[model samples]
Target: MNPTWNAIRSGLERGVIELRQTFTTAQDLWGYLFPAVVLLVVMTVMRDSEVPGTGFSLGAMALPSVLGMNVAYGGLVNIAQHLAVEREDGTLLRAKAVPGGMLGYLVGKIVGIAGAVLVSLVLVLVPGMFLFDGLALTGVGTWLGLLGVVALGLVATMPIGAALGSLFPNARSIGLLFLPIIGLIAISGIFYPVTSYPEWIQWIAQAFPIYWLGLGMRSALLPEALVAAEIGESWRHLETLAALGAWAVVGLAVAPIVLRRMARRESGSSVAARREKALQRVA
Candidate 1:
């Protein structure tokens, strides 16, 4: 067997093990469920409200958009946080010492994070189906479109996450990203129609994958009439694909260089210094 293939297989095993652990550990389980619960509560509060200019339930419309946002969050922030924490703790350095270990580590992360995202999707979706109305889940087209968007979203965001993780010095620095992410979500129309936002805000939202992912998911799950609420009264599938593809291209092109540089800089002394800082904080 090819060594790289063997490493990937090992990574797959590692990812599976980690995924199982997440279910078993109380902290991990809470991490997985907390977001879904909050989103569901928000949706419940909006269940009676109608989407602007439409009779459709606002909660129902927001459900898929929330799912799309979750995908973006998992592929980007979750992975970035994990990379930063692991690098500080010497996981990346350990991988650097072994042939193909970095490849294995990365593959493991992709698999694990993707699995977690899917689980979160199911958690929100199953409950959402019971609580919300007007979803178009029965059609084969809906499932296929959803699957495509998810795959594209993961490809588009995960490498950027890795690169961002590499750029950060520690887990604390990743918090700075949260403010921008919230701003993006606000402008991306996750809870409302983007068509109603200012033109400049609309343009800013369209430039990011979060907006496209939400748009794609809405295209999959909402009735055609809901397109009236979207920009141009269309799903804009081609634009969604183009924007996400551009991010994927740029992220994939840049991640390896950044990750390699980060790995090269890792050493026993650096990890120890980080550990000492953490201990001092705790003390």
Candidate 2:
């Protein structure tokens, strides 16, 4: 077998193992379910309210948007967090020691994260379909568009996460990323429509992938009439594709170089030195 293919297969197996593990333990299951539960609670609270001028349930509108946020968030933050924690724990160094192990490691991470995200979508989407009344879940087009958006979102985000993870010295610093992500989510219209926001805020929001992810998802699941709540009163499918594609291109281009650099630096001594630094800081 070709060495690269073997590595990818190994990674896929590893990913499957990790994906299963997430659901087995109480803590792991809770960790995965906690955010979903919170979002559901929020949606429940908003269920009584209506979108401005539409009489559509505000909570219904938020369902797809929140799904989008979950996909993008998992792809970007989960991978980065894993990478950082793995690096600190010397798992990355172990991968570095094996031929094509880094490739396999990345493949595994993608698979594991993608599986988890898909499960999350199903968990949230299924319950939401019953709880909400306005979702457009009746067509093949709806399903296809959703699949496309999710695939694109993962491609656009995971590499960037890997690249960012390569830059961080430790997992603790990843908390800093949370604030900016929250800020973006606030402006990206996950909880509400972006069309009502000021144009400048709209422009800023549109510049990032999270907004497009939310928009793409809304385009997929929301009714055509609800387009009134969207900017330009259209789904702007082409723009969502273009914006997400740009991010994918950049992430794909940069992640390899950064990962390689990080791997090259991950000698035993370097890991020991980093561990020493952490211990000394704690002391």
Worst 10 residues of 1 by lDDT: 133-142
Model 1 ranges with Cα > 4 A deviation? none
Model 1 Cα lDDT, one tens digit per residue, 1-283: 9999988998999899989999999999998889899999999999899889999999999999999999999988999999999998899899888888999999999999999999999999999999998899997889999999999999999999999999888899999889999899999989988888999999999999999999999999999999999999999999999999999999999999999888888999999999999899889
lDDT, candidate 2, residue 3? Answer: 99
Model 2 misplacement above 4 A: none
Clashing residue pairs found in predicted model 1: none
Cα deviation of 82, candidate 1, in Å:
0.5
**What residue pairs clash in candidate 2, if any at all?**
none
The C-alpha local distance difference test score for the whole of candidate 1 amounts to 0.93
Q: Which ten residues in a row have the lowest lDDT in candidate 2?
A: 28-37
TM-score of each: 0.98, 0.98
